[model samples]
Target: MTDIDAPEADVKRAGDEGLDARLVVDRGPFRLDVSLTAAPGDVVALLGPNGAGKTTALRALAGLVPLTDGHLRLDGASLERTAPESRPVGVVFQDYLLFPHLSALDNVAFGPRCQGASRAEARERAAAWLDRMGLADHAHAKPRRLSGGQAQRVALARALATRPRLLLLDEPLAALDARTRLEVRAQLRRHLAEFEAVAVLVTHDPLDAMVLADRLVVVEHGRVVQEGAPSDIARHPRTDYIAQLVGLNLYRGQADGHTVRLDAGPSITTTEDLSGPVFVAFPPAAVTLFRDRPTGASARNLWRCEVEGLETHGDQIRAVLTGELPLAADLTTVAAAELDLHPGAAVWATVKATQTHAYPA
Candidate 1:
């Protein structure tokens, strides 16, 4: 469907010299409102859990979904009333949506044909793209005969062949096997870097977002929770979802000097001293577990906790603790065996103040 019907006089403009959009879509009980802006050559990743409205935002930009409010613009021209096929947008969907009936060259040629290129011109352009993608020899292969990586590259070529002003990638790497994913991810990163247009990517994998995107926009429950450079967000997460994604234990609290009293009635000691509401965060490895209280522990923050569960985390074991405070501790197999960790096992958890980071909430 096209965007919400509006008069030409009422149409809004954005994306001056690149892309800028404030997408809002309302569907029954769900509403998606997201603001996006990017310059040419920028690669932005949209990250979220299921039903977080990430796909809806992407569709709105593509004109696949109608916008209830807000505007869409590319190169400073209005697209709020543009049809999906008419918009200067290209999409590489999660499934790579290639036509099984078409050969690889024909598939990539389809876009230019639709845009009014002659048969010979389209084929020549498609051949150049296929060659650039390292698929020149596979031009005659059908979609079914192509490997997952090959299909993905063909899909990307088809999208890029259109010479769209804005490109959208939905879970570009989710369809590949681990090995193929590794290879394609590197190739995709190189292609994206060379793309001079604005590109928006959607994925649930933290590594993909970190590796493929220049900036990250995190969505949750139809709203943006946080957004910034991948490294900045990884080191200083503002929400629990971001904290978990970056492998850290985070808590909200009110800070008084070095002590931050958690909203849940516990206190965390941090290295930074500041007043008012703040966030305290640290890595799971910062926690140490002991079967009995040691006479002289170096850690000043101690809590009586019970092991709620245990799980393998890479080369270490992650223990979930509850009772005096909720915490996660990472310990080696030998340490876990010495503590005899299990559900309901009581232990004392200690965290050195130096390991905790404090920042304004």
Candidate 2:
């Protein structure tokens, strides 16, 4: 059995038609340079912070924004200058962009009708799509009459009605409330799974990307910082932003055998036998704080740090510690109260050598 958390990259099927593109779009001070590839039945997610050029790259792929340089291809055909409507592509915008006056059926049927389908044929196809989306009973309802999830599904149906070979979704679940997002995300995952073409989705939510996509391409400042299975990236983040995003305290250092001398000041011991520059990372939960220095602790990694700040993180207290090595540490609320952890408090922190993971930088 495969690990449920493994990334899609680890198991991508070979020899299937998919997308191949190296997009470079420049506008004033902003420039997006990213390369992406996907296989048939693959769902690739472009994940990054806001203004990280994720949507810009998607728009370039959809032909809404022309590329300044590089190429766009799908299934071995070039589409550098293809018009948005002419390309074998479909897009679901951030806001759904459903036609307010059109019933759900007409909204989904519009795509087919525009492609020269007869009214009856288009309606038949649209009805089937609505049925697949569990919205057959709402075929006659207008956009306002439907809930957020329903409207989103309608948008998806409309996009798929065109039978696109490549689909693009820009922040597909950004508009939904938290609870609605969870429900719709599961639904979207099912729909994407059934899609036979290459699908690319833009999202900043790590959980969304991890749950819905087979592979994740992390972009930052208009360039791809990392690309891999979500599980691999989570276990070994290359950049500070990625480490922080994955909730790990990451540091750069030089390693010799089982120990790493951090560039920041302190050193860390790990189980890996590595040499040369490397990165050492550990979860905040692995950290233990002491109000006073311990007389004898078995852990070789210890540092005296001053509490810079404290905040609540999902029922635990996250203490921001600054010293030779600045890092975040998580403690249960009960433990925090017992230690009276507060800003400006001095404490000793320790982590076992077994807890720290080191990888090549």
Give one digit per residue, the lDDT tens place, for model 2 in 135-199. Answer: 99999999999999999999999998888888999999999999999999999998898777899
TM-score of each: 0.94, 0.94
Residue 170 accuracy (lDDT) in model 1: 96
Once fitted onto the true fold, the runs of candidate 2 whose alpha carbons sit more than 4 angstroms away are: 1-16
Off by over 4 Å in 1: 1-16
Positional deviation of residue 10's Cα in model 1 after best superposition, in angstroms:
32
Evaluate model 2: give its TM-score.
0.94
Give the per-residue lDDT of model 1 (tens digit) for 125-156.
88888988899999999999999999999999
Would you list the C-alpha lDDT of every candidate in the order shown?
0.90, 0.91
Q: How many backbone clashes does candidate 1 have?
A: 1
Q: Judged by lDDT against the true structure, how good is candidate 2?
A: 0.91
Clashing residue pairs for model 2: none
